[model samples]
Target: MNSASDAVKEIVIEIVNSTPFWTAFSACFIAYLNRNKGKKLTAEKDGVKFSLENMNHHEMTEALEDAKKIMVSDNGKKPT
Candidate 1:
């Protein structure tokens, strides 16, 4: 048998654990959406500008892994 305090403590712990899940999800969702918004805003405010298309394969892979680390770091997770 647990006291009322114990139940409340469990609920609080659960909420705390769940918070980062929601926060990371929302952050990722918002970041994805912002990319589209950024493109649109850039096109509207700035005229067509040339962008690089080609990237070194090795460098590109490294850059991607770096980005993954940043995105996953907040969740206390690491990239494989």
Candidate 2:
């Protein structure tokens, strides 16, 4: 019984230590992360969608400027 259990344990450890298993696991994990990292719109108006992940530097700066303008116009009042 002890020998059989040891054999099973070794087999499980071998499978876990194999390169193919690690490679497959890494590929799946990367795919999962990439899938989740995709562009997600935070706001939309007049058919224009805003997504930080998809924006280039210029677009981000423009959005930041627009937000600053809105904030300034609001003068500490939260929009309802």
Q: Rate the local accuracy (lDDT) of all candidates.
A: 0.37, 0.46
Q: Which candidate is the best by TM-score?
A: 2
After superposing candidate 2 on the true structure, give the runs of residues whose Cα lies further than 4 Å from its correct spot: 1-3, 38-80
Return the top candidate by lDDT. 2
lDDT assessment of candidate 2: 0.46
Give the alpha carbon lDDT tens digit for every residue of 18-61 in model 2: 65554554454344334655423243324455444454544544
Candidate 2 positional error at 18, Å:
1.2
Q: What are the per-residue Cα lDDT tens digits for candidate 1 across 1-80?
A: 99999999998767645645445544444454344333211111122232212323343233333121222212222322
